[model samples]
Target chain A: MPKPNRSFDKSLWVFHVNTGSCNGCDIEILAALTPRYDVERFGIKLVGSPRHADALLVTGPVSRDMVDKLKRFYEQVPDPKEVIVVGSCGISGGVFHESYDLAGPVDRIIPVDVYVPGCPPRPEAIIDGVVKAWMKLERLRGENR
Target chain B: MADEIIHFVEIIIGVFLVAVFGMIFGLLTKGIDRKLAAHMQWRVGPPVIQPFLDVKKLFCKENVVPRNAVAWLYNVAPIVCLTSVIAILLYIPMGSIPPILKGYGDVILILYLLTIPSLAMVAGGFASGSPFATVGAQREMVLMMSYEFPLATTIIALGWKISTLYPGEAAFSLTTFTKYPVWNIMGPFGIIGAIILLVVMILVTTGEITKVPFDIAEAETEIAEGVFVEYSGRNLGLFYLADAVKTVVMASLIVALFFPYNLSTYLGSSIHLPSIAWNAIDFLFYLLKLEIVIFFSMTFIRVSVARFKVDQVVKVYWGYLTLAALIALVLIALDILL
Candidate 1:
């Protein structure tokens, strides 16, 4: 096996996109920014635009209507990017699994580097997922570049 | 002439002490803002000593300037910002100063000096030649243009009111204006003018200091720390210090002009202390009042509202504020005639 890359371990820019879920997950995502969770100390930024982002932090189940928008957004992000499924809903549609409009577990539609498991994972866990995604990105970038 | 010379020396010393006071309050106000911002989000903030820790660490860090940066100006930007902010402190009437540089307190002079720090930062940003810094400098230029009109109007309205009330008199000096403060407007139109002036002053103060809702130049999410993006270590720290000092200076201006409450009278005007001691106490009173107003007014607005877009900010000043100021002028004129 080829050696793994780790350069993306330095800083990861996260872009958060809400699909279709209750605000519980969204609140926790912002909680990651609070003093206790303070992610800026690590150089991780919650970017407002996808173009500058290095990772996609998707929350909520992929809704049928949002499926195309999500794909378009993912396309806009530059290559050597990584995707993280941040909530159980994003992983397998969770409670919204039974909804008629449910499109997917995001991994089915996009290549996922890490799956952060929780109805809403603790911010530390989300940070871990991002770190793992960065590891995967570093590996890919090392091989390609 | 001898008395004037003695008074001038006293004013110089008074201004130096006030500058020191402004720096101290700048740091404390930042601590308070951080504590309050944390409380709003339901978390206890860092200890009040946190800002001190941050500065200490920044000082110890290795400094770096990008290879493309204009070496000389890049090194000079933060110093210019800091010096100009301190210079502004001299013109602001915090208390009874002995009158050194008293002649420099023309409202127009004070207004122009207020622009120097930001203008210096812009020059510094462009000199850095970084893409993000360039964008930040451009945004700052737009923001300054947007806010300056309303700010100018607020000053003019205050000057106009004093002129109308007293007639043909230039009561534009900080010491003179604060000495004879306008507490309330007597008539219906006067009240309207005063209220409008008060609101615009509050908004413009927030704008001039580049606080949130007006902080587009350093919008982290959009442009990645903006003009200061290229600055690191001590250079960055100086800009931060200048920013904190500007907050106090801007707040003091608001209080000196609008909320003119004097503390010496409360202690009994008959009881006199050393001139320095009296000035010190008055300075403290001015700071306390400024802190309360900034916390209750500007910081509250900063935390509660999301930032407006650049064009939106421009439209607000030109469309709403400019018209509001014009109305205030007409009302003040009416107060004079009838």
Candidate 2:
């Protein structure tokens, strides 16, 4: 796949997807948008619809019931999109790793470009993760060129 | 025949220039609104160039057409919406200058043109075949119906007073408004009534542009961006531009109707500036007026209020605001008689 253009790099509209997380990570994601962090200064807005998003900020370990819905949401985002998996649960299922209804770690279900690993990552870490995603895009763009 | 041809060329050039100006100024105003709103909330907001960058990024993204959508209608709607808004700018005066299509249309014509963008949005939503969009479309129709009454009453009240003052003149022509500023024509009672009408128009503007408080149709949290849920990429960018331009149109309308005073008129003889300098000063003053109008009617209100429910929007516009407008009309009429 071709790398996203420079304009996409400048303005990243993200859609937050929750896959049965314990609400901790999701709250941190919301915190990233509050004035304390203000992701909007970097042109990173939380969009309501996946169609309008350039990135998917997926939280939670994948629960069995949410896997299909999460996949559907990912497909809804238009091309030249990145998926950033947030929270420890999304990476290794954390406390829910051996739970009965578990289907995640999110990377098993979809290609993940960045991982922000904390029980609930701090807003600063979340912002850092986004910047990492930008660097990945830059690297991909260089490879394509 | 030769004269007609020359006139036609002038019109073509004028339309092109107006379209470009409308788009640029519209986006600029939107950027200002965001910056002002952010400051009001005690945060450093996105830069003024954010909207321009957004439109550019949107253009670069992939266009996604939903499987269930009527592709042709879905694609055509944004183009139509933007065109209609630009057309409204043609009829409404800009700064100290008359409208490009001044003689051909009037306030009444503008009233009709205002609805076309919303209607086009409704049609586009329905064609998208999404349930969320359908609900948003229905709310938009209801919101349109609710606002039109007060909007029409205010326009008619102004036109009625102007016609009474000058019997032989075209009652609804915008030129009449420029000739006889509403403040100059009114007595004490009429002035109060005119202020009420101005408030009604400002409130109507919040609805007309579908900003926060009246933005039930596109309540992102509730309906996932509603009528625009299925739109992406280039189509969404067009809608974004349409919205920005519509802001300019709504603010300009308020300026034309109530605050059409030109700086050049007041400062021309006093200051020994040249004609071009005078025009430039007047244009800058007009921009200031636009910023103030937008700040009060859009940015301040948007920051202060949460989105109203669809039913509450109807109640606010139809029930309360319409009555307020009617009272203003009555007061204006009484002023004329007394």
Candidate 3:
């Protein structure tokens, strides 16, 4: 992994991943990016390409079908990066925890730096999740020296 | 031989200076544009230095080369794009400073140079070997073709008007245009024509920079960032710098063609400032002019409207923009005959 720095904290381009999301957490992520919440003020832009991403905003319980795709997408994000798993589903599979089609929580598939535990976390909570990712990055920056 | 060597060294240093200036100013303008756009939307935008931070972060990230990509071409493309844009800047006179390589090239040369960066980008997209990039590169080529006519027409029309009036000088040179201001040699119809050309130039500039409404080739939501899909880290950083510098190139071209008159030209008599001081003043004024041009052509228009469809982009550039340019050309001809 490349060492983190101040610039990484200042501008975090995130790529959203929906591993069988129910559209609930994804909508909240969208809402957070809206003009009202405007995560852009913090320089948290949602990029289309995982290659350009500084963080992966993963949502939903990882299904059997998505497990491979999730790992591929995670590897695509360059170093000095973060993975913020949004919603309870991604952390513990939420209501889908007992479902037979599940591969399990997001962190079980790949490492997660932050988790926002809500059925569908609010925009404020999502923003907090991004902020927490920044702190983790800042700590890495400190450790780098 | 000694003086020639000295002059060569001086030109090299000046080129480096301009490249640095172009990069910094371009990023600064992009930051300001974002801030203005944010405010316009009734939201707080990122800090003015956000682009600088973004570029820095991009540089520090890991460079990812796709397994299927042609690595050599992918790496060279960004460098080619950045260098070509900087080359164009060397030929562009800014704020009473004649282009460093002035008499060697002309506006016609600039028109050609302007295409190289886009071409380099298309080349990179194709080299990346992604289906998305391939589609993006095709759209970019088509977009480039459609915009080229109006862009050429605007420059040629103005160049024709200038050449006809000033038969003795190096008529094709940007120095000639700056010396003999385009607006000054116009009657009512000619002024109208010049104004129309100015509008066309701005629209062409919008397309040239690949901002919204004309950014079909790189539509992020539609095609996963299009040409830049495979690019990341240092490669993406270089592209960002190229983009920022290209914005400066387009804005400066507009300023050169239409609004070349500087502060010191009129103020030289009354202000009694040192030549260096006056030069500084004129340069600042030129920067102000560039910002205003960029704000309208790139930022304001992009924020106010939605992105145009690929077909609409072709139609606007080829159909509407080209016709308007031709009408302006005819109007200028009428002015000349009268």
Candidate 4:
């Protein structure tokens, strides 16, 4: 396990990107920040621009139209970062997999460090996934050594 | 019959006003969540009025139902959900007035009451008969099955503890329990049990609310707006309002359970303060505490976490958290016996 006070994993910032969602996942994602399931209590934030983000929260199937935008966002984020695909769509192309105008299942395009797989996962589950990602980041950095 | 009619009318008026306030409160919380999330990421989010505007726009738009839908249920579901969500607020004790349904029962009724909107969604989805709606309803049923076990276990443990703490209490009311608060009790194991139960309850509550990572039933990307696939215009707007109101009702229930504080208590003596002063102070404290709990305990979690897979969620609740709760119950029972 990485030491309790690992600097790199502690202050991770997230960017929420929607490739082609019907807004259910997006609303649930917003629900995370609501008074009911606020995740900020753990210091995880949702960043707007990927350039400054340490984590990417991709929600929705990667539509052909939005694939370039998603790739651009992912590449812009600095290295040693993590990507979290938030809903089933982001991971498996979900219901949208059969769509004619799609290039989804986000991992095919960008590396995903964690997969939170509810239609839209709960806030606490999301937190657990992010924490898992942080640990994953530590493991990748070989910090345990 | 005459007296009952008057009482019923009074309740109707009271619930109507509370429902209106609940909507306003729900929208404000939504805005706050957006603003906070935006600030967390260092960007300017939309104004708080955005949700209201969106809902307003939805209202003005044309209403549409799928050609094959069971028109009555599709149209009626949102109203039913919204009404039930508003009705839930009546059972909770916001501040003073004991509880709207105190004589009827508090948590016992509230617990079952909380499930109504979700049930409405399920029924509505089934009525639509769309592929997306059908899948969404199936997910909703499974999700309900997944969380209800843990939630019920937690509530039972809480109810038993509350009853044990105050023996000879006839009513299993949450308002009564809150009127007397649980954290003040002694015994190390009991405290641990309470803390463990509280954590489990928070998890179960979040899951029950269908927010964040727990939101699989209506997951738009996965199920094409899930249960809401065929709804549009005012019908869609009502469901939105119902969902929002449910959020408030759930948060309020938690506050009532774990942290019911009366500001009049802080005045040192309830009798010393004038009746008006005591009432005002008590009301102020109640609202403040509720807001603080929402901001700290609930919304904070929403911001920091990601979503979970359907099977993973089922595993987490039944496989892991359920065991934790059972063990905690065992410990609490042991403590009580010893």
Best by TM-score: 3
**Candidate 2's residue-wise lDDT over A51-84, tens digit each?**
9998999999889998899999999999888999
lDDT value for model 2: 0.91
Rank all candidate structures by their DockQ, best first, as comma-separated numbers.
3, 2, 1, 4
Best by lDDT: 3
Write candidate 4's Cα lDDT for A72-137 as tens digits.
Answer: 777655555678888889889888878887785899898888999988777777778888887786
Q: Kindly report, for each predicted structure in the order presented, the TM-score of its chain A compared with the true chain A.
A: 0.89, 0.95, 0.97, 0.88
CAPRI category for model 3:
high
The native-contact fractions of the candidates, in order shown, are: 0.06, 0.71, 0.86, 0.00
**B1-338: candidate 4 lDDT, tens digit per residue:** 99999989887778777889889888777667666766675555556555565466456444666668899988999999999988888878876546555567667777787778889999999998788888888888888887777777767776777677778674367666666676765367877887787777777767776776677886755675688766755787798788777777877777777777776666546368677767767666766666665665456666778767889878888878788788778767766666
lDDT of 2 by residue, B3-90 (tens): 9999899889999999999899888898889888888888788889888989988887789889999999999999999999999999
The models' CA-based lDDT, in order, is 0.76, 0.91, 0.93, 0.73
Candidate 2 off by > 4 Å = A1-3
Off by over 4 Å in 1: A1-30, A35-145, B1-15, B97-100, B167-169, B184-186, B266-280
Q: RMSD to the native, candidate 2? A: 1.2
Q: Output the lDDT of residue B174, model 2.
A: 82
Using all chains and alpha carbons, the TM-scores for the candidates as numbered come to 0.71, 0.98, 0.99, 0.68
Worst 10 residues of 1 chain B by lDDT: B53-62
Rank the candidate models, highest TM-score first: 3, 2, 1, 4
Q: What fraction of the true Cα-Cα contacts (under 8 Å, chains A to B) does candidate 2 also have?
A: 0.71
C-alpha lDDT (0 to 100) for residue B207 of candidate 1: 79
* lDDT, candidate 1, B1-338, per-residue tens: 99989877887778787677767778778778766766776666545545554555344333567779998999899999998998887777665542346676677787899889989889988998889899999999888888788888878877877876766556687765776676554377877887898888788878788878888888877887788777765686688789888988788788878877666756746887876687778767876888887885566888799988888878877878888888887887788779
